[model samples]
Target: MRIIVYGSLRREQGNSHWMTNGQWLGDHVIDGYELYSLGHYPGVIKGMGKVYCEVYRIDATMLAELDALRSKGGEYKRELTSTPYGSAWLYVYQHSMAGRKRIVSGDWLQRDKES
Candidate 1:
């Protein structure tokens, strides 16, 4: 299965260890969404800008582990979404972005310096 990761799960980020077995498929951009700052990580919501992400191909075991890591407090929900690489699972933020800062550039790595 393929997964689109836009935050800590990307290469060199804090939680990237979970993807050690996965194949890096390079960077990608998903349109019609925006990235926002949720303190330590980023969140995506439906909006006008593109959301930059990294794609990865992983096996079932890796998928399960990722699901567990992401689904735990319901802060995010995995959904099948379309990307330039085809259909992939994307973790959409579940809570509100009420007072959060929007990552205008749409790339998590670029937003890091602003933190």
Candidate 2:
């Protein structure tokens, strides 16, 4: 199954992070997702605007696992949406707080400045 992930989950190395066990989808920057900063942590509000995602190609098993995780949290959600890949699932950011925010960077294979 293919999935689109938009938010801090973005992996600078791949579309998906091994930590999440999700296959890397791709790199993309979409808006409409609400931004709610929780100190060091943050959340996004989906369906708020025109949020785009960095897609990743992953196995169905992994997708299901991630789906479950997203559902468990108020900050993330797996929504049934259409994508270029086909009828797939997408995780959008749910704003837990309130604030006008912008993503400074995400996983894009360009490499994090930390390196």
Candidate 3:
């Protein structure tokens, strides 16, 4: 399976260890989604801006680990979305974005550096 990660899970970012077993597919720009700063990490939700992320090919074990880390079915929902590597899973934030700082640039690493 393949997954697109935009936040701390990106290469060299915090929580990136979860992807140590996965193959880095390369960076990608996903349109129609907005990225936000959620303190130490970031989250994405359907919106008008584009989101910068990295794609990775992972196995079932890694998928399960990611699901747990993302609080699948709760804070975030894993949805299949189109990517350069065909369809891939993306974690959509389920919580409210009220008061959360929007990462207008859609790049988590850039936002992290500014914060």
Best by TM-score: 3
lDDT of 3 by residue, 14-44 (tens): 8899889999988899999999998999999
**Model 3 misplacement above 4 A:** 112-115
Query: Of models 1 and 3, which has the larger lDDT?
Result: 3
Q: Assess candidate 3 and give its lDDT.
A: 0.92
lDDT of 2 by residue, 1-115 (tens): 6676654556542323543666555545555454343433344455354444656767877766776766675656666666665655665565444454333343222223423
Per-residue lDDT for 1-115 in model 1, tens only? 8999999888999888888899998789999888999888888978899988999988999989988887889988888887667789998888899999999989998995665
**How do all the candidates rank in terms of TM-score, highest first?**
3, 1, 2
The best candidate in terms of lDDT: 3
What are the models' TM-scores?
0.91, 0.55, 0.94
Question: How would the candidate models be sorted by lDDT, starting from the highest?
Answer: 3, 1, 2
The global C-alpha lDDT for each of the candidates, from Candidate 1 onward, is 0.88, 0.53, 0.92
The lDDT, on a scale of 0 to 1, for candidate 1 is 0.88
